[model samples]
Target: MRHLIRRVALAAALLAPAMPALAQETLRLRMNGDVNTLDPISTTNFTVRNAAYLMFDTLYAMDETYQPQPQMAEGTEISEDGLTYTITLRDGLMFHDGSPVTAADAVASLERWGSVDGLGQTLFSKMESIEATDDRTLVIQLAEPWGLVLDALGKISSNVPVIMPAEQAATPASEAVQEPIGSGPYRLVPEEWVPGSVVVFEKFEDYVPRDEPPSMAAGGKIAHFDRVEAIYIPDTATAINALIAGEIDWIEEVPADMLRYFDGVDTAEAVAARQSGNSMQLVVNHLNPPFDDPLVRQALQLAVSQDDFLLAAYGDGEDRYLKCAAVFFCNGPYATDVNTDRVLERDPEAAQALLDEAGYDGTPVMLMHVSDIPTHDAYYAVLKPMLEEAGFTVEVQPSDWATVATRRASKEPVADGGWNVFFTGWGFVDQSNPMTNVYVSGACDDAWFGWACSDELQQLREDFAVAETEEERMALAEEMQRLTHDLVSYVPLGQAFPSVGIATDLEGYIESPVPFFWNLQRVE
Candidate 1:
């Protein structure tokens, strides 16, 4: 049995090609969605985030144990009272553009990121000021002591705290950035980019990997290939075929339906190399009608079924899917069933009563459905009529995941290109901790997509941050979960654990929650 990474992953069944082994130089792989916005702070999609992980470096990164490890920072100095933190940049750090990374660059990067990412907003609320005290040093004066500051800085999720050149990082969070500059081992090759087809990257010769061995998103981010090309192959058959024919070296994700195609294929080996992860969320825009009424939100929550969604998405099985009953995650360390009693019960009659009581006047729910992910189809198929049965009019809007990423940002009314509901997922890593969870932040307009806000949610998160003991934190987590149910933050459909196919000849693939490109090398 091969050593697989992460807590749980799909038995990707093993992967690679039938072609003769060759030295790894330029690795070729493909994925489902197109990289939306390279501007790290502007978007939150798996495609863009995975690419950003390659092109950019952060102040801190997560090790295998999920602890914060210094990436570009020499070390962090905190005042005893925890009211102040001074971070000094690692010496000789240089961006892909050959510009020296300075303390000012990191300050601006954090500022811009805070304007968008949910965790960043939390940090901003506690921050009195964050400025460069010297070329190599950043001094953070907090309004109060916060324990998750480093965790926020080291957030490994999308809208990640990817440090950039001060000028580039200065781009307004509302606007998409044109440049993709960073200090990571791989430099994104812009000219080779094709809008929806291919993205090319070349290794940076000047990159300085840390001395320690690579682990998770930290340590030495040694790039073993001279070039890496990610070709968007939305069709699983095409992607798998490419892998089998040696036309492609790896496929980031192999859809559940395609797993059968790999059975007994000598050259193909799919491994469940990561954890059983990601939740399909039925997001209702709180900024608009229907969803604005907690009663209506509760109605929708009652009508839908997680089992129906999961069966359609991953097929009926315990291995392919997990019955997640909580807003955080189903079975993880901090998973709780705070307010999921109603959610777990599929009651159309009760949902109708709630909607009728809310005076919902048949307002059309602009359900923005994603066409990319194979499982998303199951989401739309399961949700449309259930909402209609519960006294809500459903308008199905169709598009790729990239379009969903942009349109979800709209705060407009449903009639004016705004969205009422949509489908998306988050790695459990983004949720387990109350303070780190993006969906539960309740930062109002600054919240992820739907812009859900609640005073109770915010207060709970703040308290969760300062919590010192495991018992206390877990108790707070339950309260936060309870609050999440009350606010109807977002309806979590279920957990879908998919696997990826990689070349059996390749080595140094680290098992992580997300797609990682560093530390891989080709061998015969």
Candidate 2:
């Protein structure tokens, strides 16, 4: 009888419903690439911006319409002269450590970012200084009237200003890397960051939602996830398998060809739409030979068939290429109706004629590529054959993204005495304001092609910078675009549609031009 009872108890235990693990409540999102650093000032890469969004809040956030909305600041006022601005802070706001966030902290954070030698300082160089008038208010004095200040504050690159604690800023740089403190919705869980594998964040219970409610703020919703676990899944195929097997909740960059595989899965749904702030193009090192010749650059530009590349990289009929009047602002101002088909169509004969005219006698050209970027690899593959067919001796050189970025930053010559041609990509500035991000004389240093800075371009940039009215700014921007189009610094190829995969039951999973994980909320 005791043996019988024991058997019955064991059977009951086996039949009992499986209870969820205590940690299952946390949302885990597998990202395509690893972040270089959590520091906002380090680089302007999207991976860094996505990570920072969870841990930091900017002064002004962007709304669905891409308008600026106040966040930590309760309200702001622009001076009549348009040179000075005053920002009022919200009351009862506190950092993760329960210390009150003050105007002093805001000032210090801006100053720290402005003083740093990286991209943020480059963007915010317009600011003369930020002064704290009181515990609740901060005043920003600009070198000149910048109409795009509000717009700049909402951009993914330099816009999301991560406010660091005063005490933490005072701490030495060596110690600061290990110690990160912020007032965002999530706090860093030091133990969960397993070096190269994953970084986890636990939601801060004390995180105060923006005071005037969601309607008043940009980016309509506050962070809703209780916990966010960002696992670094480097391999594309492994990430797809993990998603299909339900090992991870979501994947950021779903490979273009793998879209159909997820269609039949009942629990998983795919979200693919036109992604904003991204562009793929070929960059020529103007200082280098062959490309240094305008005719050669134009010839190369004419040889590329954007349609073929778009289909291959983004799947057949799944992508679109934009035609802008100026190379600088592809989608914005002074974009008048003109025939771009002549320039973008694959014309090998025309390309060869131009090359011959420029005295190119079959000299070898090096094409630099970052190996990890699948899209870039795909673009390079297409371009190589085209160039070779046009009677140019082309060599393709591949390196890791970091190495490529370092090389580009250092302006070093490519292997075999430097690259004459290379393919690269960039994120879009907010609402097609191309002047600030991609325009030759704008924030982008060294102009991508290592071209000598033109005085004419510099003057044009200055005019756009201080243009009082929208009409004036647009005109200047148009002229700048005309210059870039004529010069062909970098040939504009195409834009990408970000593919996202999410679980079916997940609600509030709206698609954005910029792929951000913050919008996921479970309704079911």
Best by TM-score: 1
TM-scores, all candidates, are 0.92, 0.80
State candidate 1's TM-score: 0.92
Off by over 4 Å in 1: 1-24
RMSD of each: 5.6, 7.5
Worst 10 residues of 2 by lDDT: 10-19
- Candidate 2 lDDT by residue in tens digits, 1-524: 43443333223222323312643455667654554456654444456556766777667776666677787778889999887889998766677777888888887776665554223444466778778999889998888777767655554554356676776655432122454677877877665565345667777887777644343125434567777777665555555565565556777766577777786787676776554436666766776677778798788877878777777677663543453323543555544333355356778998899999999977678776555556666777788898888778887777645445435544455553455666655655432554444435522344433453456766786666667787887777667656665566677776665577776666655545545555466655
| Candidate 2: C-alpha lDDT | 0.62
What tens-digit string does per-residue lDDT give for candidate 1 at 316-409?
Answer: 4468677776767777778877778877888999999998899989888877777766777668878888888777888887778778778878
> Which pairs clash (backbone N, Cα, C closer than 3 Å) in model 2?
277-427, 277-428, 414-418
